[model samples]
Target: MNEAGDTGLAEVRVDVWLWAARFFKTRSLAKQAIVGGHVDVNGGGCKPAKTLRAGDRLRIARGEERLEVEVLALSERRGPASVAQALYRETDASRLARETARAERRMVGATAPPKRPDKQARRELRRLKDGG
Candidate 1:
């Protein structure tokens, strides 16, 4: 058991880890996401209060993006981005997949809707159709 003298607990809560690691904006949001099945710990679904420790793998799905990271440290309090980053490490495959998805999105930007026929366009189409 990895005990933190302050909490006197072997590990930190999953939701607290998520929030502290910058995965969610708030602990409530992290709990909500966990309850909603947006997060998986060690290939299995976990609850907000699930105990988390170093070396655990997590799968977090946020919108269309999914991140798989290995927990490197545990913390209950939120910190700056640099400190938060030290809490976990994203796997290489996950990083490559995310970049590929981003590139695909950029290449397939929103398509323009088909042009509608206005008064002039309608008349022209009608004339063409009528062989005039």
Candidate 2:
């Protein structure tokens, strides 16, 4: 009913909107992020129950990717990915920075050891440690 052509009549909760937008797997996780100070609304900390309106700015930090997005629509219930995408618009700079950081992380991880050593590698390491 507000701007951005959103059909919803009422403002949505920040956590619910984040969940509906697929920012988090669940509303609980979104609430946790808000409480942890990883989410900022309009450049300041806000509660999970904060009402989100169209055109509001949100900054969310999830692991190595930080996102700056503008609320485009309000939805309390989660929907399909495409529909969820319509709920917010990520800033171009945020998208580019996220991609760059992801690439950097991939490059760094490419040189790291396997997450778990195989039996042969484990035996070899043990033998070397025992001076065998």
Supply the global lDDT for candidate 1: 0.88
- The C-alpha TM-scores of every prediction are 0.78, 0.82
| Predictions in order: lDDT | 0.88, 0.88
Where does candidate 1 clash, by residue pair? none
Which runs of model 1 end up more than 4 angstroms from their true locations? 1-9, 110-132
- The per-residue C-alpha lDDT of model 2 at residue 15 equals 92
For residue 93, model 2's alpha carbon misses the true position, in angstroms, by: 0.6
- Go through the candidates in order and give the C-alpha RMSD of each one to the true structure: 4.8, 3.6
Candidate 1 — number of clashing residue pairs? Answer: 0
lDDT of 2 by residue, 60-84 (tens): 9998779999988888777788888
